[model samples]
Target: MSLKSLIQGQKPLTISIISFLLMLALVIVIGLFGGRHIIGYLEGQLVAHGIDHNQEVIAGMQPILERGLQDGAAVSVIVSNFQSFIEHAEPFGIRLFLVDRKAGRVLADSQNRAAFPYPLNQLLDSMPRQLNGAPIHDLANWDGNAWRRTASGSVELISLHDLVVPANREERWALGVSSDLSELLVLMDSLHLHLDVVLLITYGLIGLLGFLVLRWVGRRYEAGLEQQVAERTRELEQAQERLIDQARLATIGQTASVLAHEMRNPLASIKLALSGVSRSEGLADREKQRVDLVLGEVDRLEGMLSQTLDYVRPVVRDEQPVVLDDLLDKVLGLEEELLSEKKLRLVRSKCPQCPPLRMDREKMQQVLLNLLKNAQEASPDGGEIQVSLEADDKKLVLTITNQGPAPAQEVLDRACDFFFTTKARGTGLGLGLVKRVVEEHGGSVQLGSASGKVLVTIVLPTAD
Candidate 1:
């Protein structure tokens, strides 16, 4: 079909599918990046809290040390005060181990030492070396199994600190204090659970939304497919009807051929007899000219008969490659005189690089001529006819258009069938012949009205 006709008849499914896929892709991309952001934020919060809690524990020990150094209080007394401070500080599990600078003794404990015991050397050796002279701490390294009865059931952080006392001007005794972090571990667990639940719900909603959207898309796609199939089926039926009409025309043409053959000899003999009588009888010049006009009418009728027969004969499909631009130029050459006689203006354009198609050159020419003639007839004096060729990677398309009133639906429907016409003296086989020739070339012919113009298009497969 022609470019304008094909564009006007396009379905909306392709555009709809592209829009839906873009929406889905956008959501997927957002979810991927958003998930990364969420995970990064959670990890950052955990690390920040770990540092904060460790700092709080170390800072709490400063008051106890000030009393021992400035007031010259006993180490044992400072240790007892520090123990009382931890027991009431917060609900979090806290351990305090105050040992001498030699790391040999525990002065105070958060867990009841009577119930659970801790090995001093084992704890000190495990301290992280990166701690800048302060004791090491880790949230994941706490052990509750040693004091199962007193231990809260959770993974936790453990903080350790050593109490330093001056033994001389340069040396001091080192003591240890450790804090248990079962409560923060519990908070972390709760935060993780909340995040997981939110993620699950969000993903579920997204999945449900995607399913509904796809279902809606699927329904729309099916409806469009059905509509397209119905439309194509109707066109196929129309094509079949045209084929049947061509068969009938072939039948009529055969009959007319026989009748013409029988009448031509008698008509020629009568013309010769009339001429002889006019020459012998004192006929005036005007009377002789009138006799000659009668002969001309007979010849015109004979020519019309021959044209009708040619229309009925099925077009021979030519399989050779044809350059469509050259073919269009050839058709234009044949119709130039006719166009000039009608005073119709013709405008032509071609793509920069049009592909060749395998088609019958004669048939294509005939189709173009028939469409151009229709355009010329439809338009008023000095009306314009436009012709163009457009090619893509796979198909070559031709269009011919003329400004005119739209044809009635009934006329448009039957215009490409044999022997259908609206003109007073038209033979009415023009469009039918065009249809036969186009189909024989394995292309399609289409006709339509748009924007106060009538358009005809031909589409042929190309080798690209």
Candidate 2:
């Protein structure tokens, strides 16, 4: 799969893990480059130091050769003396050679007397003319058998060719010194091994720390996205609820108008019959009293029917600017007696910053009264009821809470459904009407139960 597809298919934690692996690869690359640079730098220093040591050896051996030549000693005697010096030296791997410059032949060798005349022709053939009285250095590797059969390794070779005039003699000699560089190579190898271990540890630690940081940032990002999704879902649900409420209101309006028109005629005929019977002289007093009771029952039924029809009637809004706090005060004053009878404590919290809102005053009053009455009925005597109004830049929120036995989950779920109620005598249209009125005003209503209390929340958009 492509990288984008792989990443998209993974969870947040899995993405973090992938980032850690990439970081490890980066660390490996950095470690390799760093190790190579460090080893190269060390090898350069070792080679430079070896060249300087080889030049010093050439200087030290030149004086010995000059003294032997001034004394008229044979080349063999000089070679034997050099051999003796090499045997007593601390660094035994050094080799010295003395050669005749004109004839290009070895005159004395510290490594072997039998190797005299040992192909100085090749050594001189490659040497530069006009040495400027300074030594020339080069590096070469040799097999162990060629030298003293001791070891095979590389060496720094320093060659000096100059005209030397001993007393009563003029001769040209080329002096050469070979310094073993095996120890320097060994040191480089050791440094490389140690560097490898150190770089491995350093990269490992860095990779681990990077992984942890990525994991933390990934979790935080995931949490923020989740919160945003939840908030958006809530807003969409509120919008859907408002649409449903509007549709329900329209359906109820059409149905109730027809039903009420039909029921009114029958209710009027029943009232006329009861009135005629009560006035009849042929009837006994007990019968007349019975007619009176029937008339009272008819009036009660008529009142309930009228209320239901009124609830379903299409809302005619007389929109005006009204202060929310003032509106609440007026509604609470109207319910003073009922609240006092139940001994219910009323707590009010209002936001001072709430602006005037445009809505139908009479309809809004009805909505508030219905909700308060429900709260009062559900609350026990001496229970507390809380009413709070809060506002933000976009909306106004009102909440009414009453301390009481919570309603069943099923009842809460269908609280806004027409003719759905928990009370035995309730018509179940109160909350449905409230929901319709609120939705008509571009608002939403939510009913919930928690902690043995009923909560009703209303959210209304602020005036643009």
Candidate 3:
């Protein structure tokens, strides 16, 4: 795969790994440089210790040599005394040498005369001229078997050269001491090894822990994204179903509009013929009653056709302030005959505090008539229908309820759905039309079965 694609595909895991690798690299670099710095510091301390040891040696031997010289001891006697002192003194892998400046020869050796490789004249000639009253020190690496008895079978040697002048003497002496650094070097190597092991273990553990944490977080994030995708898919499916339902409703509305228009002329012709038959002198009383019944059915069909047309058409509202009690009284007056025919009692309850509402007068009247008609039709013989109006905050609430067989819960839920009905002769446009009108007036409608009755509540905004 291309580098960019690979990086993007596994972005989180890749980023975590890259970060961890960088940290590990940083740690490794710091360990290396820090280790070298520590080693250098230790080596410096060893060098300082060697210088101190050389000074101590010089201080101890100087007084003894001066005493021998003041007693007029011979040169051989002084050399013998120095050798005896060296034999009795502590040996910390250090060897001392004495040299005569005038004779250009080694006077005495701490290890052995054979251990001195170069003559005193050659050593003095090679050294710097200025002493500055301080010993000269040098570091040398020795690879010979002469240091086989030492710690590592090889040695780092520190050499110090000091100039000594005796009282009443024209000759000067050179005192040299050499110390081995093999043991210190061994300790430094062990320290470095241990540091490397610890650092490696620490980095390994940290990298492992980081990897596990990243894996866990990645899994959780992936699961969350998957859940979101599933939820989105479900929402899309529901939206698609709604779109299908709307398409079906649109087709039904178009067909109903055309059919209602086509039936109107024929229905009018039939009604005219039925009216002429009822007025004829030759018709018997029974025939006339039958004709009147047919005329009533024709009128009912016309009303249904008109309602279908209204359902299909858009509403045009001319809004104005309307008093709640006055509007209810008008609708009830229109429904008076139907209520009497069904033997249903009307009970009106008006809250004195009810307020005027802003609505289209014609549309609001139609909504109240439809609701009252539904309550009349659903009520049993001598059943009471209750109509109540009250003001709630900034709105007017109206409720119409009747004692009747309660509608099924499912039917009540879809009571406002277009063309949905439980009644055999229902056009199914009454409640739907009421809902449309109320909504157009910035109001809401709800239907429910409660307390052994079907209740419909309408809320409309009050005028300021």
lDDT of 2 by residue, 1-464 (tens): 99889879998767777778888989988998999999988877775665677677776777877888878987678767866776554357766666676565676666654656665644432332221333233212211111111225443334443425475764566666655666767778898998988898889888898788777777788899899999999999978976776677667776667767877788789989989989999999999999999988788667767667767665675556888789899999999899999999999998899988888887788899999999999999999999999996689999999999988888888998878888777778889889878987889999998888899999988864
Name the runs in model 1 displaced over 4 angstroms: 1-243, 264-289, 292-296
lDDT of 1 by residue, 241-299 (tens): 76777678768888778867887788778877876866766888888888888877777
Compute the lDDT for candidate 1.
0.66
The weakest ten consecutive residues by lDDT in model 1 span: 142-151
> Which pairs of residues collide in model 3?
none
RMSD of each: 13.4, 8.1, 9.1
Using Cα atoms with residue i matched to residue i, what is each candidate's TM-score against the true structure? 0.46, 0.59, 0.55
Task: Give the alpha carbon lDDT tens digit for every residue of 173-227 in model 3.
Answer: 6566656667787887898788677777776677677777777887998999999
Which candidate has the top score in lDDT? Answer: 2
Report residue 311 deviation for candidate 3 (angstroms): 0.6
Clashes of each: 11, 0, 0
Task: Using lDDT, rank the candidates from best to worst.
Answer: 2, 3, 1
Q: Pick the candidate with the highest TM-score.
A: 2
TM-score for candidate 2, residues paired by index? 0.59
Q: Candidate 2: which stretches are off by over 4 Å?
A: 1-37, 48-98, 107-151, 157-177, 208-320, 333-355, 358-360, 376-406, 417-419, 424-429, 433-464
